[model samples]
Target: MSADRGLWITLEGGDGTGKTTQAVLLAEWLRDGGREVLRTREPGGSEVGVLIRDIVLHHRGDVAPRAEALLYAADRAHHVATVVRPALERGDVVIQDRYLDSSVAYQGAGRILDPVEVRELSLWAAEGALPDLTVLLDLDPAEARCRLDSADKPFDRLEAEREEFHARVRDAFLGLAAAEPERFLVVDAAQDPESIASAVRERVAALLG
Candidate 1:
């Protein structure tokens, strides 16, 4: 939380919202501007996180919802300790693909758990570390599903959930953005990637200035 620390930016949304693409673009743009940037993703940001990601996202059998939430929290704990926090403390802009908000939406709303509790668990796990700005790529669940289908990638555990689950996740993200407008920039992800990236750059420029 030091003022001298670099910005921590997170891109969040349901599956197929193009968070990965945006994260890459943002990091590249920042680096081109001469900022030291570290682009990472949750549930697989660190060495330990890779193992956790497999268990959480691709485990063959069913995982208890609470257990799933705790697993994500565990990954967050390790990821912040070993990767994210150090980078920020060293004054490197960190463009992360997901964060506690994903847990709040995927586990809390999508899994029918208490969103506040989910957020609290993640915060405590990561010692209350929060992104300076979270870019939420908001897209309709139906359209998102269509995009996922077109991608032809094997569906992960969370991505394979029903439409209703995805709908709830989308709603949860919007609700979080509404609650903290200053910390979140909600963009229409259905736009062309170039347009979306341009919008993201504008917000990030303001932050950097």
Candidate 2:
């Protein structure tokens, strides 16, 4: 937001809550309203980031919480440097599907890692950049799992965890929104996709104003 270019908005939620779809819809709406929007997602938004994503999410082998957190932070560092920062400098409003909050939620609270430690690592990864607005699409864990029906494509390594884990992550997201009341907007993801999109569009428009 300080770059004299565009605002940075991020969409965050548990698995299958439709963050990607809503992000796309909001970006399209912003563009139609005559703004340049750069749409992207985390874990694999860049070259090295993609490999890092696979390592973090697909490696079924033993993985320590600290080490796993480091991998995620590494991918995010690349993603912000290569994709997010440059786009913002060019006057493009960046609508990132997921960002730093995911790390704090999934690795920190969901994995039972210390929040202070997670914050420290995130500070290193992100340097000074942060989102202007973070829209958290809240959803029930059972509902989220039902949405991800399949053997062909599995949930992310973090997302594939137990329901209690996701519930903790969701609570963490809510706490984050409460802690930073000005930045995060909590939205119910239980509604239909179209209705959710409409709600997001309305919130995003308000944020930009």
Specify the highest-lDDT model's number. 1
Model 2: per-residue Cα lDDT over 1-209, one tens digit each: 12246888999989888888888788778878888888887888888988887888888787899998998888888888889898888978998888888888988998889977887787788786889889899998888888886435766677678989999998988888899988888889998888888877776777666
List all candidate RMSDs to the true structure: 2.1, 2.3
Clash count for each candidate, listed in order shown: 0, 0
For model 1, residues 111-195, the per-residue Cα lDDT tens digits are 9999999999999999999999999999999999999999989999999999999999999999999999999999999999999
TM-score of 2: 0.92
Kindly report which residue pairs in candidate 1 clash with one another.
Answer: none
lDDT of 1: 0.93
- Model 2 off-target regions past 4 Å? 1-4, 150-152
TM-score of each: 0.97, 0.92
Name model 1 segments beyond 4 Å from true: 1-5
Best candidate per TM-score, number?
Answer: 1
